[model samples]
Target: MHIGKPHEATTRICQASAETVEVRGRDLCRDLMGRLSFTEYFCLLLTGREPTDNQRCFLDLLLIAIAEHGMMPTVQAARMTLAADPDSLQGALAAGLLGCGPVLVGTSERCGKLLVEAQSRLAAGDDAKVVALQMLQDIRKTGGKLPGFGHPVHRPTDPRAERILELADARGVSGPHIAMARNFRAAAAEVWGKPLVMNVSMPIAAVLLDLDFPVATIKAVPLLARTGGLLAHLAEEQQNPIGFTMAAHAEAAVTYKNTDEGGG
Candidate 1:
């Protein structure tokens, strides 16, 4: 059976032969191994091109910014999974990464989409502030959330978001996307009654887009960054053995309601 065009397996990322391995058209052993830092290597591997200095610097920055945040739910899930099955380290990592839904480390992707949409509208001569206000109103009208805003824990503002924007300006990389993000900040304060804390996700998305990183691959950065965090947290869980304690706390935090207990 055949459907549409015939499929062929291929990847531009890497190919290995008996003697040498190639990645993004560079020799892994000769060209990339000693010459590139891990962050630069990551950029090359991801985009198939070496990054500019600003790109490499901020790629490293964003990775550090999103890497660890106390015992976030993702880390807790990893720790708890490890506590339940001490031998399955891989499963624990998978469990943690699985928790990176849109509400978690995956939030930057939504923010990326938001920025892209706003940028397209801006390029079409729509005023960024007006677009932000209209979009905020539409989302509010539909009872939907605007991504890159709000946090369950961080208050007043997200300091990491501020720092990222500051660095972007310092590095001369802040562009229209960053401007639009700021416009959202102003529009949010006016439309939402109070200022929603613009979290780190927005800056990460804005800076990367401004630097010309592929819009589609914006999520990969956070996912990769959080994986490093998860590994460290999982190791800590192994040493301190708090996974079960966290589970116990979770159980104690909520009462078990049995509406049908002996009702039959």
Candidate 2:
């Protein structure tokens, strides 16, 4: 018995024939090989269209901004995975990418969706501050935390986030979405009675939204950037060998506790 649909199979992303390969109707070898930057090519591959100049520039900037954050959990996972296997590069990379979830590199997508929700409220004629506050209140009532509003290490603001917004302003790409993010920041401070740091995810979402990036693919930006970082870490892991040491450190860092034995 078939578990699901078994007869559906099609791909519009690429078509290859006996002598040539094509992506989005462009010849891979002759038309795109040296002409498109990797960022431009990534845009094409994902959206089936080339990005505008601003889109390309911001995309490249965001990628660079997120590519390396020294010794992040994903990097450590990749390093340890490489150290354990020492042969399976793909496995090591997969180990790292698997860790990109709501708490880590995946927050950009969630924040983008949140901003879009706020934009909808704005479109409905509510003031930006009201929308932000109501959204925060609603999230809090449900025991939910606001996405993209705080970082463990970066206080007040994330420099990468600030740079992205600054560049967006300079390039005239800061639009309603960015405005909504800033309004959310202000509203969060008022609601929480303290200044909460705005991390890179918010601006990553805001600027990408301003650039007309598809919300569905927002997470891909971080995933792709972190892949590069993971590769770098894996390479260094091969050279320096730390996976076993990290494992040993973890073993030493934890202790089992028994209530009866402790009381006795």
Model 2 misplaced stretches (Cα beyond 4 Å): 1-9, 259-264
Candidate 2 C-alpha lDDT tens digits along 1-264: 888878978776899999999999899999999999999999999888899999999999999999899878787788788888889999999999999999998999999999999888888899888898899888877889889989999876799999998999999999999999998898888878899999999999999998888899899999999999888888888888888898788789999789888765
In candidate 1, the residue pairs with backbone N, CA or C atoms under 3 Å apart (3 or more residues apart, or in different chains) clash, namely none
List the global CA lDDT of all models: 0.92, 0.90
Estimated TM-score for each candidate: 0.95, 0.94
Regions of candidate 1 where Cα sits further than 4 Å from its true position? 1-4, 261-264
Where's the lowest-lDDT run of ten residues in candidate 1?
A: 255-264
Question: In the order shown, what is each candidate's alpha-carbon RMSD?
Answer: 1.8, 1.9
The residue-by-residue lDDT of candidate 1 on 49-137, one tens digit each, is: 89999999999999999999989988999999999999999999999999998989888999899989887788899888899999889
